[model samples]
Target: MRGSFRIEGHAIASEDGMIAAANGLMPDSLKFPSDQKLYEQALDQAAVIANGRLSYEGQLNSPRRKRLVLTRSVSGLAPDPKNPNARLWNPAGESLEAACAALGVTGGEIAVVGGPFVFSLFLGIGYDAFHLSHAPGVRLPGGVPVFHEQGSGRSPEDVLAAAGLKPGPVQRLDDGVTMVEWTRAA
Candidate 1:
């Protein structure tokens, strides 16, 4: 945990490290019941969830957990007109700490669900742990990578390692799906 904040990231990506198709949408091929269950459970324990507009829109009916939606539409932090439990945020204009403070979230798990940009932002900020699940036999070529850079000779593992996170032992989830908990390197 970093300074009383237990930041964690959750994502399910294709074998090729794509989290979304070229159309900027997450394909069904990446979804797994096992992963969804774990993702929901993790979110339930989090004090606040943060994601980009696309990620936030994708899960519109998600349980009413407090959320911060990243968008350039807001100068900094502003009320989400549609959801009283949410806030529209522009990290470029304000610090994450200030955004969280606006939502009355002092310290607890900050669950970061993602599109590539959101994931990349948190990677820069640092994560206490990242739960990465893979859908075996699936590949989304020319799709959105879990990290920002692609076709750059760096795999998602390389990106995570560069961010100082080490993978824990792998666990088989379901139907060939596997998961690895990446934590800060000791």
Candidate 2:
């Protein structure tokens, strides 16, 4: 099966911990229609590659589908623990590819959902789909910059394209963020 977009990040949550974009953000219900569409896209992305964070272990955090939390430790997660499909783990690897190797995941189809560092790490290594939603040019004077680190290099799209992702449609969110979807070329 297509492993889907590869997103890898590190955070010292529980061994099986992970966090999703929706949880990290303010209510998406407050956003405008276009922006909401983007939010909905994120919510609808059946599989999300997230940073291992404690938030993912919530009884409520039980993923609707398969959600993986990649860590270097031996910790594990199970929303029900009883359900065989629901899983969590900490793999040994310094990079996503290495972890994917251990997990048997192909790693090409992943979207690279990031908390910061992961996005930066995978940007050029074959990053495909980028869903960035900001409050349309809205900036908090003292607020943190959204991306892991502002790229002093190529535009995200450029870097990823150079890495081998096929450019797809780019959708603008009424809020500051835009959804850039990319696919690996066949």
Candidate 3:
């Protein structure tokens, strides 16, 4: 999951915890530079669990769009009878386990791009790996925390460790950003 890290570990672009403000737009100051190619390549052939907004616009527009599965939680929503690429998940009506099974999402890398709630949901289930990116020199003071349960005084890394993931080497990305991968400890 990709999150913006500030010195204080805040996640959202602002205190409102809105990725995009009332206008549905993020300010330039909050936008961190990223490798577009890497992001595109990762989405190829991957099952993407994203919110309704992103499912329709962002991921669906990719060139590897055909290989991607769009899963969202919307009441009364379902994959088109003829289309195997979309899945509608009702968290209130179904278990995450059941949703995954119904989507036929089994035995491969599952990318979880999220808001804090989604990240917290998966934390309980467990993650085989987590790629945490830190953008130095940027701070979203009073912004949302990447892990909703965080700021009870525990750092995100501490939360991951508590969940049994072991940190891997740090990989530096462009623009003063760095990422560290954490794998479930054997």
Q: Rate the local accuracy (lDDT) of all candidates.
A: 0.85, 0.41, 0.51
Clashes of each: 0, 15, 0
Query: Tens digit of lDDT per residue, candidate 1, span 23-43?
Result: 998888888778888888888
Report how far residue 147 has shifted in candidate 3, in Å. Answer: 0.9
Estimate, for each residue in 1-186, the C-alpha lDDT of model 2 and write its tens digit. 123444422221111111223345422332456654444344445344444343243223344534455444444432435344333444322444444444445544443444444455555454444454334433233222234334453344454466566655756554444455555677
lDDT of 3 by residue, 1-186 (tens): 222211111122233233333444434554555633444455564554433333232544553332223344455346644346555665555555455556565434555555566566667756777767665555554555556666666667777788888888977777655667778777
Select the stronger candidate by lDDT from 2 and 3.
3
Per lDDT, the best of the predicted structures is 1
Each candidate structure's TM-score, on Cα atoms with residue i matched to residue i, is: 0.93, 0.48, 0.67
Model 1 scores worst on lDDT over the 10 consecutive residues at 56-65
Winner on lDDT (1 vs 3): 1
Winning candidate number (TM-score): 1
RMSD of 2: 8.2
Show pairs that collide, candidate 3.
none
